[model samples]
Target: MKNAELVVIPSPGVGHLISTVEISKLLLNRDHRLSITVLIMKLPIDSGVDGYINSLSATATPRLRFVDLHLPQGDSASQPQDPSSKSKSPLSFFANFMDRHKAPVRNVVAELTRSDSSSRLAGFIIDMFCTAMIDVANEFGVPTYAFFTSGAAFLGLKLHLQSLSDDHHQDITELKNTETELRIPSFTNPVPVRVLPSVVADKAGGSTMVITHARRLRETKGIMVNTFMELESYAVEYFLNSDKTPPIFPVGPILNLSDGGDDIRTKQSRPIMEWLDHQPPSSVVFLCFGSMGCFEEDQVKEIAQALENSGHRFLWSLRRPPSKEKNKMQLPSDYENPSEVLPEGFLERTTEVGKVIGWAPQVAVLSHPATGGFVSHCGWNSTLESVWCGVPMATWPLYAEQQMNAFEMVTELEIAVEIKMDYFKGFHGDEDKKPEILSADLIEGGIRRLMMGGESEIRKKVKEMREKSRVAMAEGGSSYNTIGRLIEEVMNSIA
Candidate 1:
């Protein structure tokens, strides 16, 4: 048997890195003849994946290795740039950071090829944002594959919109704030412009960056998405039939379902689990926005009021917003006193009924039998986690492609209730326009609908999808077969 090696390049964000690592594990476990080396990139802001990586490294096997592309000494690329500059968006900043590492990546690839004679360099698997690394793969005379961390539906929408822009010269940025509805093929219903990704909808540099990545995707040998065919059958079918896209592999529902290592186990895990232990099965609503999700004090107060008024057993993961300083590169931190932003005496008022904690162990919380429903920002990973655990969701999208994911969940899948589908909390450097705050009544109504009964339509649908997700990853399943096909393609790529 021929031994082959593949290199994976993931984005700096923890969410993207987690999914990317999961896929790498799947590939390694599926085929014994293959080895994977993941090239890690550092973010200008510390997103705290180092501890997770260190833990993995401590237990890593011979076939799996992690190489950190350390930032150059005294390099400004490691520091936060001017956040006040309106011209820079998050995507652009990330893209520029990745681009600066081209020389280092090339050096690593050169070393790998020179050091290994028994194991042939098969191909490169790059995150969607790291498409610029494709050029390096080309230089080494190897094929490049894109590992899309989001769903197939979002992938289709991105490619379709980019095609429209490139082939027909349509300016999608002009559709921002309009009532125009787009007939995207991936979705069953017409998608409203308001729910478009903030990067694509706005006329910022990020829109151009998104298009560049989409165009680069078309250059890959194949695209492996972190979604199964059952969850996104229409989009998968569309890609399989279309001649425009490269071979599409729906090889996931890939997730990191562990207890999130020691950091999670030691901090707040026991209390949260203890509280869930006493609640009735399917009684508590778990509200955890993504790592980057946070709101202003006024919106936080509204959420507190809604949770109090609903009277449902609840676990809320509330985070403090990042500082508004011009040059600080920071993520949302856990509030020492959540009551500072929440309603007066709210924690005291709901002592028996609810628990408010900072930085939840999301996978652990979702898998708890007491967790009846999820009120999420509709990030794809969170959506998949909820589906995998058979929990229904109340969608409240904040930014990025979350609005698109929410639309698919509510309108297409019918597995989630909607709080506000088109709510856009603009990212850093976005125009100074505050999104409309959802009222307490509106939020409470959505929570009621989400957790009303054990036999609700959405609940049933989520349970059904959860089973499908499992089957998709099982042997002889859709994702399983797709992974086999991907391995075959990788082996065949070697000249």
Candidate 2:
């Protein structure tokens, strides 16, 4: 048996973990003798996400193990309160966790180095957020590859925007003051500041995450992002040709590897999928804002009223009100009751057209023939999933780099169209009121455009892109070849 081992580090989030598992599987599927160890803290029982990790452990044929690096139990009270939720400030708690835990992770690296298999530690694959892993890899003289769970367009913009930050005198919002265009090398469209990831454009110096990211970009030995070449060929080409850029490998549609098929079949994802099945094809518009995003109760009501008014079939994932207390937050008294919150006689009238639920099987819904369009927050995973499903997007980017992703989808690649935007400036924190929300009228127009009328042009382009995505994963496609080469390279490095 070949004695080679690879350690994969993933940030502690559902999206990051899921993508890492897919790459782990790709490695094992190709090399039977490759021993793999995944470094994660612990699985949360509440979310039922543990199954994904266990599933990989069960199928990795040769040898695979999880090396859990956990936080001290007594420190639970001190555990950062996911500053993301607590602070609306531009700072990211995700980066803070990394900064605080670097020492413990380094200790884990030392423990691995002392093992009998230390000599066999041939490679390290780490999420972009876990930049500290590069130092660990250097400690043992192992080559490291930075694994980006997002698409190429967002990644390209991130790198490009970082460079722009060096020279531009003003912040992202100020850049938006004049309708100035953001000129990135790979993309043809000049995106506005309002369309970039919120974090990058913020002038607040508290968040050093982007600084770390820029540094890692220049240091990593190789770069790997979870996207196929066909879906992001332009961005991929630019990265490859850049001076001093690490070797770029586009390997993904990673979620599609799930044997459960495109639908969310697990108990957690089932209820959502079941509801989607009852809706008619090409008629129901699916809207999901990912796990972390939240909107005010009134915004939710407005969206509900708009969908009802448009007379379009729809499925919405609504978050429960923040606090049920009378004073803390006020929801439409009828909000909990579907009949009261929906248009008068709306439920009965649109019974054939709409379904409202707390959550829905997103992938299955998108892949379904009935789901003609997605109104989304434009997260990288959602964007890629929509592309894989031949579904066109009605982009409504909420926060983070999502706006950047939405801009690329609409303006750069022309696979989707943005809902009309109203920007808010001088907002100190996310907890404050949003500057603008896409009203029902804008949402209705977006749905109509993407579903029919002049929007058919975008739909046709997406369908063709979907074919390209399929081919890239098939027998002789670019992504297929890249995966094969990556496995071979890892194995050869060991020998």
Candidate 3:
């Protein structure tokens, strides 16, 4: 048996866990005698991630297991001792929240390393944000590779800033005091202060600490990202050229991790897919905001009206309406009826046209033949899934790296149309137009463009990129070959 063991400290988020699972699966499929253990604050169970992992594990063959590590009670969620929490200021409230989990991260690593079974440990795959693992890996004398859950473009920014903290701490402090664009080394493209990743931009102390710790990644054996070379050629080239950074392995377009079986169908997912089956090819629009996205009641109502007004076949994922009781989140008045989140008489009016669900199997929806275009928040995973499925996007970037991903998709890749823009910045300039936020008129225009409006060229481009992503993931293509190489390297490497 080709023996190797991996310890992954995945941040407790669906996207991060999904990526970690994929890397572990790739390792196991390569025939390595692997003991893959995942450490987390809480395993998603019930309606959360635990259910998803359980579903995946039931079918997994062997050499793979999801391990749950319990940390101090405060490591997860701490119960508020009393109702006086209402009196606390927002900043202090958040600080207390973040403080609780800080210790558990370090504690988990120390506990894991000291375990008797860890003798066979070959390396550790730590999420880039979990910088403490660098110390743990160093103590165990094993190679450490950072797994960036996000894209290469974002990683490029994080790692570049990290390098600045490492070599030119003085310069960074000086630059931060004034409002100036921090020119990332090797990236000729300028990134504005506001456009930087949220973690790096928002936290003064934490940002510096993260970047300083991030420098340790360069000293490690390798760095792996969930993106492909062709998709991020320049960024990948820059990393490889950087003497300070380690070799980057772009083994991504990771839809395989999302894949279960060609025939796999869930009871909850069946009704939505069945409805799509009745729609014409390239005729339906798949609209979904990611898990964290939400809008004011008015905005939600406007969108519901627009989808109703579009008269197009659509499938929309609606979040459970928030409760209006005092001290509770409130849903829009229109969503008060629960079923009314669709539209007044929407299900009845569009019975032949639309399906509204709290959550849909998005990847399956995107992959369906009827799904021709997507109206989305431009999340990285959603964007990748849409491109992989060959469905074009109607970009509606809500926040964070989403805006950057939208620009890359629409401007750099020419795969989709950006229908929204920040109107505060005059759109008359040479800079690309912002995608229209999901307003009623903008939503209608976006849906029409993706369906049958004057966007055939963009749709065609998306189709071509889709095919490229497929070929890359195919039996002997770039991603396929890279995955094979990754398996061989991990299996043959020494502790």
Candidate 4:
């Protein structure tokens, strides 16, 4: 069992890929006896994952390695095209890719097994989206685990949904159609169905996909979550005691030690870093969305108007939606001159107080001493990064599970202030053409509260959570021991 190897196949997105890679790193570090090989597929547009992977591999132990896997493409004409939208929906495309590529990926796996007899396949751990690969593991008579990207609360809720699938009760489909709150475990307050991720709230038949995915998770060897036991004691407890659940590993708050590792951050960080140096400690609020944090033209204008009104020191990383060819979740490049769409003279007027950059070196910016608060889209990864940096947030969830994440941060954790709580992107219809629901006044108020300490009383809370995250990853901490427990379980099973 010492050299037993695990195969990891991640979904084709930067968030999933990076988190999964981090898990691989933690696993290898925890047990020198373990080995891992990651199978990857490419995103149509680059979001720096390739470069990150290269750097990781260069420094990675010999026990850990990666290989690229290709998926066959289906007809483009058959794809769903949301006209008037700059970013095309990637859901169907990925779903189709999974279906078409499953066979070939299995063939590759079978061949890899034949060639590497010494490093026997111990098991498979895959992104929730790559559930199809479970079949390949089953075919090879191996166990499979699900690497869920979100927190334990989300998983507890998903397990609840799975149990609701029996007779006399409805499945996720019926739950989506209802107007009641869901009684999910691990969270104190009842969650409004609308605030739940689209899988349970999507009116567009998308919940059906989520339901299917949740069902698939039930069949895994276990589901690994990126949260620590301390941060989610309620959740870890709930799942562990729940019936019909697999082993739950709260193996994170897995901190990324340094950011600004890629060439992109290095090239773009000079100006942003310089500006941060001039500011007072913990004074500036940095506004950035995750890779996909683009706004409609009017929304951008509203944000500009709000910043001018707030009169707070700020650095806004404004982004436009990429053309159909790019990764929607990427940080966007800003206007060399932002005055192009700004209320005229907005740049010069706020010159002393605010700076706008296309791609503000996020990790660098967030980690800087001057950044105190974040106006964010509340992507889970970005949320974790902010917590790790000890910065508080004003949450603005746009799409996907962002709304749910926003809710968790604000209501559940009380670590963030809510900007526009009930907002849903698809509800506006013709997504890109959707009107801005958040007025300048509302945005301004949220910023003021976060920066000035109103109900956005996040300064003390975030600092405490940040320290918890650090301790949790340190020796003898909850996360560190969680990894050890997981390694022992895997070893015992194979032994």
Top candidate on lDDT is 1
CA lDDT, every prediction? 0.88, 0.68, 0.65, 0.77
Clashes of 3: 10
- What are the root-mean-square deviations of the candidates from the true structure over C-alphas? 1.5, 4.5, 6.0, 3.3
Of candidate 3, the 10-residue stretch with the lowest lDDT total is: 422-431
| Candidate 1 structure quality by residue, lDDT tens digits, 296-393 | 89999999999999999999999887878755457788999898898889999999999998888899999999999999999999999999999999
Two-way lDDT contest, 2 vs 3, winner: 2
**Candidate 4, 1-495: lDDT as tens digits:** 446879899987566888888889889987788888888776655667787787675576778788877654554423334444545445565676677657767877788789887777789999978887888889888889888888888877766776676423665666554678877777888988877765464455466567678778888988888887766777889888977688888878754555526666677788889989999988898998776666767777889999998888999887665554543333455566666767878888999999988876676788999998999988777888888888999998877778878888898888999898656664223253454568899999999888984423578889888899899989999888878887887787778
What order do candidates take by lDDT, descending?
1, 4, 2, 3
Candidate 2 segments exceeding 4 Å error: 42-51, 54-62, 76-78, 82-93, 113-119, 165-178, 256-280, 321-348, 421-433, 453-455
Clashes of each: 0, 4, 10, 6
lDDT at position 466, candidate 1: 96
1-495: candidate 3 lDDT, tens digit per residue = 445767787765566677777777776766546667776644222224565576686567646666655545554243332323455432333344444544554465556557635336678888765655676677678788788766777777767776566666644444433456656653445555544433354344546555655676676677778777767777777887877677778877875434443233376687887888888887888888776455544666777778888888888776653332322212212232445444467678777888777656788889899887898878788888988888898887665567667766775577887666222111111112433345788778877777875448888877777787777777887777877776667666752
TM-score of candidate 2 versus the correct structure, residues matched by position = 0.85
Candidate 2 residue lDDT tens string, 390-490: 89998876656677777778877889877753232121213335456658887778877777744478888999989988888787888888888887787
User: Model 4: runs farther than 4 Å from truth?
Assistant: 72-90, 171-179, 324-333, 426-435, 453-457
For each candidate, what TM-score against the reference? 0.97, 0.85, 0.80, 0.91
